[model samples]
Target: MSGLIGKKIGMTSLYNADGQALACTVIEAGPCVVTHVKTQDTDGYQAVQLGYGEKKEKRTTKPLLGHFKKAGTTPKRKLVEFKTFERELSLGETLQAADVFVEGDFIDVVGTVKGRGFQGVVKRHGFGGVGGQTHGQHNRARHPGSIGACSFPSRVFKGIRMAGRMGGNRVKVQNLRVLKVLSEQNLIVVSGSVPGAKNSFLILDK
Candidate 1:
């Protein structure tokens, strides 16, 4: 529902009231501008499209430039539609991180995990591989071993967790506790790690 477009600012440790160190991922959220508003009577749905970050005019498409122009805002790097909002907002209005979230709130962060390129099963799927070095195991330590049956199935089954491209998948981390909110800086700190590499875009939803 209510959400904001943000960029991953990496992770840091914060000391809590009990003196316990909490690991949290820092995100630079919002100052997002409302680009479009979809109404039920017109678009058959209720949603608000928010834009965050800035892109060079040359790098942005012409149609998108026209869209941003209609909103009275510069070109934005990201655009996301949210179904729910705290209150009805007008187009071209800006929202900061503190407007949508607060400390101690539970939110979901959606992001893409870092791509690991082509990976082997041992690292990608956590296969233990062949144990021990004796018994003519040789270099088959990290091999997937038997993949298919002798004759009954004959071929490898679909959806098998073999080696292939790893990571770079969209991941949703839910119920992340909001540790701190710096409204002035447009920053939010949440407990635990979030997906994606530093500077990657993320969607924080409530």
Candidate 2:
């Protein structure tokens, strides 16, 4: 359950042995600072809190400023707690992306899907609207036809798929293979597409 907090940089393509192009996501993984350490005896749990990205002092609260100062680091933009690590980590210690992941590793990426605001049924639920415009169906093409029964359980049923809000939800894309780990650049290239737009925070878990 060890991982790092990363920022989705963008996507790129790579050619394999057969010269086939493969799409990959590029993430700026951490050179995160170990902000806090929790032990069973102290907090009734075990977790290592790491901080990533840089934020200004003016933007940070007084309490958070003190917390970062105690860790011997500057203000950070993100804080995440991991349950365990391959190696013991001390408070105030720094961890690079290469230290936690390697090439060929399969990792799960957690992120918020891009916000789509309000959407209709066709776009939201893959609904097959009234197929043809026959039978006086002039303006009913993309409608979610017939929501209720006549006098039988009268109300529209709960859990019936209807269009409302879409996206902007937490999602986990699992078992994406790690294609490359550029330690010098603090970047990790992973196979396939990742959720959310560029610069969104992602939790990469192993």
Candidate 3:
């Protein structure tokens, strides 16, 4: 399965046919335009390049301007390619949210996660530091207890979980159910939380 490019508009609750409130993620899927087609003979791969979201002509560079003009489309803010597309689509073709998905379908959503800068061992690595403040534990509340054995390796092994930057990376949430498809509003209501904050680019796949 495949999906058009979209922006996550956030999440909300909706009542199903059985009157149970279900949580759903609202994304503004496209009427994405096919900008270019990659063929096996030329590119050694098969894929379709899609353009989504609009930007002012002045904001787009001249190179991009020529590219969009070749595709006969206005300057778009984002362009993404979808590989192994199931449908036979062509350049200048428009793909809407309704054409890609339906209720109860499982999809994988990929996006950049929200950034959390420079976290400590407890928050970043989930380490339970020394648990008592009463026993002369001066400032070892969130410190990593023991890095390594006394003189076994004489140094900490690589890849030991440590505090550092968190999030702000490409993340894929897989097997999320499509709860609703609001074609009228060009919205897709998925079953759970997706990566990134509001209005982030999301790629959906089956």
Candidate 4:
């Protein structure tokens, strides 16, 4: 289970050998520095903590600054721990996109979806609403009808799907085929759309 921190660089189309256009999401992956190597004896688990993206020293906390200093790396914006790395790595070592992924590799991407703030059932839960514009229905076409039962059970059931805040959730997109890897640019092109908006941080793992 090798993984890297990345940012969604946006979407683009690629032409295959057959001249068919393939939609793909471009990600700027890695160039991550290993900040810490946790061992079973020290931390009860084996994992590698990697740091990616630059951060201003003033914005970094004292504790984190010390941690980065110990690793001999500059401040980083994102830190993530990954278990089961492909190879043993030492602190301060760098991991690039090409080191972990290759074209035709299947990987999983985890990211936070774009936030939609407050949303309606029609948009959030795919509810069809009232379904008709007639039958004395005017502004109720998009309303969620009948949320509760008659006096007996009376209350809305727990875990009922209603409109509220949507998106901005951690989502995992699995089995995304790696279409291309630009090692020099630390970029990877993956098949299909991934979670989150452009420039959003993501975790790419295999």
Candidate 5:
């Protein structure tokens, strides 16, 4: 398959063959169940829907419950559609980490980053504050200075990097090398860190 839904297990240090320790992120990849398959004739495009993470039946809605029932699987918390696959997949078929990735493969990861609420320009846009602490700039140390033009434009421009909310964005980190794949555990170790908090869902793309 071109991609799989996974959870960020966390970061750890792994030693390579050259005896160098490398920082890696461990992801609990599928065991994703195929929930739906769309073909060219039926949907105008080819795509396969995969579901991950278990959900209690009582928490599921009527429409979603019926959808899972059609696939012959229990309720799933997250459902994602992938447009590419290595082979044809039937409904309710399971895919693990071994199926989509292997060691030495380069892939991209998509996830939501941890949120930092109500930040300033210093933290959000890397602006080096307003003035030095040596002066009487107490609150101005973290302030965003000079946001508008002097009388000519007369208004603040759009897309200025003044901070309000920060992070919690859907970010894609690309070209992470796959370090290890544990099929039995449905886990894959990848070089470098991926975005998001622990247990947050991530899309691993080839």
Candidate 6:
């Protein structure tokens, strides 16, 4: 599947062709550079590495500096590899949002979700805790009740669903419609809420 790398620029409402106001998330999609192209014979695969977002030279390391220098491009904050794309891509080629997708195209967006740290079972796993609000139940309302057997196992299982750190995982939302593509500004307005917060990296694929 072909795709483009982008950054979430926040949400806004825009008018459709029918004059209906639609809520959308405005994203600053590519104008990305094809940093490297992997060939089947050489790299044992076919893929293109796209570079997005700019960064200062001081923020880049020596090894990355060398890599970007070889590609004849400035340092980018994110570099993502995309497989299953159209064949015969060359290095240093510029990819824009207009070229990858247009209005009404269906795409899959991949991003990392916002992190929620150290949560309880109720919030994390949607566990309906013991006791009702009508009854005078104590402070054990949202707690995880009785993890396991005591004398039988004597220890907690390895894969117990205890609450801890949540979110911050890679999520792919499929079949989202591209509402509009602003070519001049390199922006794209997609139909629904995407994963992650504003300014987060997003990968849009077919």
- lDDT for model 1, on a 0 to 1 scale? 0.94
- lDDT by residue (66-90, candidate 1, tens digit) is 9999999999989999998989999
Q: Residue 52 in model 5: shift from native, Å?
A: 0.3
Candidates' C-alpha lDDT: 0.94, 0.94, 0.87, 0.95, 0.94, 0.89
User: How would you encode candidate 5's per-residue C-alpha lDDT over 15-52 as one tens digit per residue?
Assistant: 98899999999999999999999999999999999999
User: Tens digit of lDDT per residue, candidate 2, span 1-206?
Assistant: 89999999999999999999999999999989999999999999999999999999999999999999999999999999999998899989988899999999999999999999988899999999977989888999898888889888879889988879999999999999999999999999999999999999999998
Whichever of 1 and 6 has more TM-score, that candidate is 1
TM-score of each: 0.97, 0.97, 0.92, 0.97, 0.96, 0.88
Q: What is the alpha-carbon lDDT for the whole of candidate 2?
A: 0.94
User: In candidate 4, what residue range of length 10 has the lowest lDDT sum?
Assistant: 130-139
Clashing pairs in 5: none
Report the Cα lDDT for candidate 4: 0.95
Off by over 4 Å in 5: none
TM-score of 1: 0.97
Q: How does residue 84 of candidate 3 score in lDDT?
A: 65
Listed per candidate, the RMSD to the true structure in angstroms reads 0.9, 0.9, 1.7, 1.0, 1.3, 2.3
